[model samples]
Target: MSLTRLLFTAAASVAVLAAVPAGAHADTGPYRMPPPPFGSPDAPGADRLTVSVVDSGNGNDGTYELECGPAGGSHPDPRAACGRLDELAAAGQDPFAPVPAGTYCTMQYGGSATAHVTGTWHGRSVDASYKLTDGCEISRWNRLTPVLPATAP
Candidate 1:
């Protein structure tokens, strides 16, 4: 091609490249934009929970994704689970609060089941685990029943 034409093309290409956003070349995997912060005014679908239960002895184990604020997910009963969570939040208590100090707990062994719950509730993060080892722990585990798979009696 002519020298002038080549020079014009090269300059135009450089200008176009400089106009592009720096993030345009970033490789942030699937999500191009960072996920919205939970409870942020601009965040949608931020109130959600992922729950998992494991009971090797009883063969009762499953994982469920539960959403609140509108109460939707693969959970068996989103409404009930959300209601329970709302109750806990309304009372300003953590659903997975440790056995209170000086509280009496029976010495009976409950069972061999473990559960994990992680998600956002009331815009706050929740990463809790439950095990049925003692009376108090059993009760805590029971409170999240249905959200976490219920152990066979």
Candidate 2:
């Protein structure tokens, strides 16, 4: 395979691996993977977010209210979504982080689905947009899974 193809494959592999359950350890090498989270994080005041799918092929086109730290709201599955977010946070990964600069993305198209997420997370304000325009974007969307919807490649 060409160097470029190999790099793309590696990046894609990374993306796939990133979709692993949040409770999975991020460490590499000899570190042993631990069991899934058995305890819930203490519920604080209210960390809320609103997810609006501007365009969707599935029934998820409407808006949803998500409340974490206690995991209650209009979101389809607040517990799972909040658990996913908790896992990401514990792994030191920002679920809403943007695609890094200059990162090459595959030309593969995921879909025309568009989403806008707004509210406060981790005590910080958040307003992010999501689109399944390319490979990286799709992976990012999938990373949030049911929080968004596993409707992409």
Candidate 3:
């Protein structure tokens, strides 16, 4: 299988694994969104972000809310996303850094999916875009797996 397919499969797996049970019932009407697994309203400098992805070519689009310092959000895998960010912070790496030039990549057209993440995290503002237009971009996109949907909307 191709690397792109492998990355997609891994992301899909994460999403499925992180899914929470819906507590909806007839008495409650629509399902009440679950409280976050971590973090609290009173916590100082709690992280919050609004993430979105749009692929006009393939009609994949979605927007979700993300809060960390205790992962919680509409994001499919909040814990993983937050963990990635934390790892970057720990290593002094920039999550939004441009993929290095001349990096070897296959000439594969994964998709035209484009995603953007905005909001605050780790006490800093975030405004980032992700795409799968080429190998380097695909690598970057994969790093954000499960945060952005793997399939077209």
The candidate scoring highest on TM-score is 2
TM-score, per-candidate, Cα-based? 0.62, 0.68, 0.58
lDDT of 1 by residue, 14-55 (tens): 999999976687574565676544334454436789888777
lDDT of 2 by residue, 1-153 (tens): 999999999999999998987667766446675533322243233579999885667767789999987899999899999888888878868889889999999999888898888997775677989998998998999898778865633
Specify the poorest-scoring 10-residue window by lDDT in model 3.
Answer: 35-44
RMSD of each: 11.5, 20.5, 24.7
lDDT, model 1 = 0.75
lDDT order, best first, reads 2, 1, 3
> What overall lDDT goes with each candidate model?
0.75, 0.80, 0.72
**What would the per-residue lDDT of candidate 3 be over residues 1-153, giving only the tens digit for each residue?**
999999999999989767844544356566576633222333246589888888735444778898886899888789988887767656666676677787787777677788888886554567988888777788788776666666452
